[model samples]
Target: MTAALVEEAVKKAAVAWINVGAGPARALWCLPVDGTLIVVSGPGEQTAPELPEATRATVRLRGDTGGLIVICETAVARIAPGSEDWAALAPQLAAKRLNASGTADDLVARWENDGCAIVRLTPATDQPAAAPALPDDAQAAPPRETPARVPVRRPFRLHRVRRR
Candidate 1:
């Protein structure tokens, strides 16, 4: 896919997933790199294990026919067709790998023979601009005053006492 197309797809696909391995399940940002996807497994406060550049992968799709086979690297991975393991791993791989740096044929070959897949690299999505602040000179509206409460008193009543 073209760089722009890849970038758009990555942007659309970029999402946060829970790292279940860690207790309490932490959130991580899945960023798309040039030829791989980077998963910020945890916020800066928490430290995560340093993963290797390559490992076995399984790709699975939601409500799909079959899974694909793949191999995952630091920020990239390769996918092969007709691999159930690859399908099971696709979501995680896609979430982690965004950039398409290598050629499609190379990626396919890597998967078909070596049990790996090629992921394209895409540009990071731009954040939305902040809203403009109101001018200091803008007149402040006066606060509305609440009505004061009044107390009600009942008049004293006198009754004639009957002698027993």
Candidate 2:
């Protein structure tokens, strides 16, 4: 379980990045509203998984020393455009999206025009409640979807391609 103070710290964070042991981590400008972390991602915004493809994911965040800050187990829900949740979260995301193509008034319009989804991640509601307090150190390792695997690229490979 995430403590109230930790959650507040997350709320204050301008961006949160999560990777489910996949290709790469995605960072989004998010707002923690009502205990739910609301994130918007798509082609023109932050990159995120399609989300609807997975029901649950382990989200990890690190503190100043790169320590785990409550490895959150969350249920992923994709909020479609034009819904009440989208209506509420879109404006905030747009305001925070520094590179958005249009003015604030045109943000939602741009999303609808581009086809984006508002994904909300909440503490997993199904599983048994977690320990009330998380270790405030490196004792916690991020949960992985699968066992460890080999790296996709060579660790000591040259920085640039060799001349032909």
Candidate 3:
């Protein structure tokens, strides 16, 4: 019953916050395939440091209302490019990627060329994946430091001169 809930929660959410090892939880777009979640990380992709090397990770999914839904421990497996699994799954992942620059094939090629890590996250059967209850306090944290910044607005011409 709990496993079903985990699967249902995962199926509904497009993104999940994954914490690999002792690192901070990072939001990653996920693709559900064959009862597992597929996540890609590397250069020009989402940042998930140590995910490919880590054997285990914690996956947190949010509800439709944007609230916490379920938290699960997942077994991580890195799928090598050019493998049978990669061949089948990469196209699916590329199709699901929103705002992707190129065709699915092109994106897959780029992923391959850039040496991206395609990881499969399987929910662990032994560990409890679901949270007992929703917490009363708001789960908010200070924003992480980044070099990227918002750009200034361009000048607007409010009034137009009337032609004689």
- Candidate 1 vs candidate 3: the TM-score winner is 3
lDDT of 3 by residue, 1-164 (tens): 67787878777768998998767889999998877899999999999878999899988888778878777899999999999999999999999999999899999999999989999999886644455665556656677787886668978879986889
Q: What value of lDDT does candidate 3 attain over all alpha carbons?
A: 0.86
Model 2 vs. true fold: TM: 0.65
Of 1 and 2, the candidate ahead on TM-score is 2
User: For residues 1-164, could you state the per-residue lDDT of candidate 2 as single tens digits?
Assistant: 34664465456555666655453555566777777777776667766755545677666555655445555667888888888877778888778777767797698887788876778877654432223455545443465464566559856866777898
Q: Candidate 1's C-alpha lDDT?
A: 0.33
Q: What TM-score goes with each of the models?
A: 0.22, 0.65, 0.84
Question: Residue-pair clashes per candidate, as listed?
Answer: 29, 0, 0
Q: Which candidate would rank higher by TM-score, 2 or 3?
A: 3
Please give the distance, in angstroms, between residue 16's alpha carbon in candidate 2 and its true position after superposition.
Answer: 2.0
User: Best lDDT goes to which candidate?
Assistant: 3
Pairs that clash in candidate 3 = none
lDDT of model 2 at residue 38? Answer: 77
**Can you write out model 1's per-residue Cα lDDT over 1-164, one digit (the tens) per residue?**
23343344344434422222222322333544443444422222123232223342111111122211111112223334566644444444434434644654444344455433333222222321111221234333454343664556876659865789
The worst-scoring run of ten residues by lDDT in candidate 2 lies at 125-134
lDDT for residue 106 in candidate 3, whole number 0-100: 98
* Worst lDDT 10-window in candidate 1: 59-68
